[model samples]
Target chain A: MFAPRTNRLAVLARDWLRRAVPRSVRVEWVRLRRLPRWILEAPLMARARVEDPRRDYPICLAWHESPLQRGLFEGETELERGKAINVAIAASRLDGVRVDRFQVLSYHHLVGRPSRRRGFAPGLELHAGEPAVGIGGGCCQVSNMLYLLALRGGMKIVERHRHALDLFPDRARSIPFGLGATVFYNAADLRFENPLPFPVLLRFDVRDGVLRGELRAPEPPDFRVEVYQEGHRFAREPDGWIRENWIRRRFSDLEGNELRDELVAHNRCRVCYEPTSTQTDEESRAAGPR
Target chain B: MLRALVKGAGLVAVARVPGGAAAYRRLTRDVLGTQRGHVEKLRRVVPGYVEIWRQTLERPLEGARIWIHEAGWTAYWPAVCYRLSGRAGAVTNCEGRIHDQYLSRAIAGAIATEIPNDLNDPRRIRRLRALLWARQSDELFRTLEGTLHERCVPTNLPLADASRDLCHSGGVLEHYRPDELAAFARECRRVLKPGAIASHVLDHRDHLWHADKAYPFLGHLALAEPLYQLLHGHRRSLSYHNRLSPEEVVALFEREGFRCLALRRLVLPERIYLDADEAARRGAPGLSRRYLAPRHRAISEADLRTAAAHYLFQKS
Candidate 1:
């Protein structure tokens, strides 16, 4: 159910509104409005928390690293470096944390509120579908890496959040688009539960300007998990150009025999920046609606 | 603008001559030689350069692995700094130009004789005297080889990730386009360890004013984008300026995840007339609002007149 030409008109109107107002004003306003919800959700999240600080002889399972900085789109401010600081602050809280069997590990529960008093810095963050700079902005990078680690380690995702808008052009993207998980404290979070009997330790570090995360266990796993992206494509929809992909998870035995294959996530996000000429030309040729 | 038009035309004419490619290459070399003061100017300027870095860093630079962008033929800035202060632990000169063996040694030899004897450090002075006594016969290059790593790369850096503690450059930022600068900033973030710093010296004034007195210091800002590109694009092989304001320069790196620590600006006394309005009051031909591109047109007069700046940025 898409209305033709509506996407382009809405985009133009949104852009006009954005230019009319100052970004700092808009960001401060949004932060002020989100404060009440953030305060109320703090105790609600503490109700189901599980503390698993017991460490065992570690067996590393899955590891992933994402760069803290990426090439920015035109007119966008340079908040990525600030984001790196935020990521480090948030990632340190996640490091060495272990999730026990049937225990739900909420991202906000561990990282807490990314408040200035907690040493979080101003960084690029998306608020209400618009990119803005706010306190504890780049914490999503930590959640994104943790999500990837959880998926590859065969953990069950309890709750996750994805961005509605893809904000940047892919300059040196290693993973498929729409793979990152966005987090905004208690309202939007990444939560995963340990399905296996053994505890899974989460290790994170901001090493060499990359957010590195590793999933570890007490003993070697009999099965190895792998993730593959399928049917990755961009489409011109009524609202805007949208990027979509299917994340497929495969379970393999230690001896390399395939055990099971299953669909993990189907992601779709509206493209914020204009597609490059080649993408535009390709989309124009195959599209039903302009 | 006229000077750029003439220079551009002359370059085109020179290309039409026999063996013109070689001739034009030599001309570009001469341009760099005169403008950059290749080696002779190095001995005089190296000490001041080191002092500026010292003041800005507020600490000793000893044992810091430094990656210098666009270290020219001699790479003598770091070379002399290494020899004199003994501060740098290692130096890697990343340049787009191929390293010249004979020229480097010769330049090192010549710079050795010109080393100021009034220097404070007796050990450094003794080292210089030893070089002169030995006739500098490849001793400098051999010593530098032990600590200095020079590699010619067009885009990507050859160093390992998080290997360098400091990434620095002088008079180089304006030469890169916005996209190229964005890529370079990303590379800097990738190579430098977290909390490491990048120090850059930028000259925002028009380069044409260096040689030609006819061109105003802010004349480049007055030209139309198309006309400016036509005269000074990459094919010109001259000093092509991207004409970014100091704020824009800082923002470009910041966008690539660099946090600005210190920005020291220098506005020359002569260019005090911020924009055309101030210039009109003074009855001088100044940068006009009408002539500037729409992007440049909106810039504040304070930003328009910034002649140079030293930026100290830290990797997050």
Candidate 2:
């Protein structure tokens, strides 16, 4: 179905354009099909290969269970173990290498089984349910454990999602909602990149039903990093009917161990209720007084 | 045109549309008669099964509570509830797979076999004989135990809120050793209200073990013989054939402070074999029929009934 020999050259124009440009100005175009036969034969092909260690490194993947399990079992009154796992993943950080993409795979979902008991029917078609209920109904605990471990490892945060609400009563235990990482298969992923010059190792284990995660990397020069709670506010909708609670963030360096105490001005979020018969009297009284 | 006209005439002739003004009570009476017949048949069968169950219950339950154990998927409980008294009645399940068809049928058959009249069928006689023989198979029973441990665990106990008046584990007791079974019975007694009942359906010795054939007498041999001699150089002894006779079972219950109400032989129908494949796959050779060949030397109906009897007991 070729129009002509001239048409074949047109299909390869993108490749020719890349070769014609300088390396610094051109975006790095790495094609797997164009790689040499020896590199293609290796089993570790999926791993990232970088020529410069000072620039590029793989992200460390860690796993843990104890803290995650405690938070999962006793965090909420309803015993929401699954959501706890997700929270743990968001709070975790990459260790040696910066995490570029993070994914959690539950064993049940991999095996085509319903991971929860919310809705089920008897007979041949037993393990059918919503896609979210596949494998690891409460497996977010493992993901959360990895997240916390990554944070302690001093990895930069690239992407994260927080829980819908604060899970743990302890302020330190709860990851800030907007700053947390929320992951869903094929939709959202936890990702970050290492800017440091060294590589990190991620380790995880489950013993006696407790999950443990650890990040191993060479120690870096001490840098004073202080996380501050700026202020909390309730934003009113344009119609003055809906209100959303939010927290503002400001990052700085700590000269001392103690955090600075400051009271910021508070803004009143008025209700945007539609002016009904009840409000008409108040509105009339205000106009008369004016 | 002529053919079409003739066909239309035929249709018109056949179409005798009913005139609603007429009384036409015959059709209504016939419909009512058919409905009555169906209702009568259901009334007859339901009550018959109930009566048979009640008769079975009367045979000296001493203080034993009747338990109907199934895979939990079977409609066995509703039937049992209909026949059983509501006060303190309970059902316990040891189901591995929630939707397993074979487990359901086997459990149902074990419960159904408790009735006396079911043992009259010749095919059921053969099955009972085969079950007894297969249960005695030391190798097969061990394999089945491994499978059970892997696939099934008690998941519903911790969630149960009701107090039990009677405890019954239909075909499950046979899966454990006599000591384990006894311990389980003790546990059941602990949970049961004071003066409650406990019943267990167990295996009688007289079946095959892999390729080796063992008779009911083998139970006595395996139990009475010393372990060193039986296993001379082997790692383990073939010990599952450790079944007790009716008198011994009664003694065990008495020793446990239970009153022996009734222990009678029950003969069940041959439908047990209809759903035997899964049990056979799980090393239940009696249901598998792999080693059992049709022979004239099969156990007689009376003996099969004796071997397939249900033992009922009451906690003192």
Can you tell me the DockQ of model 2? 0.01
Off by over 4 Å in 2: A1-290, B1-75, B78-90, B95-97, B100-162, B205-242, B267-305
- Angstrom error of the Cα, residue B242, model 1: value is 1.5
Best by TM-score: 1
Candidate 2 residue lDDT tens string, A1-290: 66876688886886797678864344223322223422322221113322343333233332334643454234343334443433333222221222222112221122122224522111111011112233334444444454455444434433444443332222354543233333433223343333223455554444454556665444442232222223322233564432122332222223443211211111223332343444344332321100
Residue B52 error for model 2, in Å? 6.5
Q: How well is each residue in B217-258 modelled by candidate 1, as lDDT tens digits?
A: 667788778877766664434556888887788899899998
Question: lDDT of model 2 at residue A173?
Answer: 40
Q: CA shift at A251, candidate 1, in angstroms?
A: 73
Predictions' DockQ, in order: 0.00, 0.01
User: What TM-score did chain B of candidate 2 earn?
Assistant: 0.42
Local accuracy of candidate 2 as per-residue lDDT tens digits, B138-200: 222232221112133333242132244455554455435457556655655556555655555
- TM-score for each candidate, following the candidate numbering: 0.42, 0.27
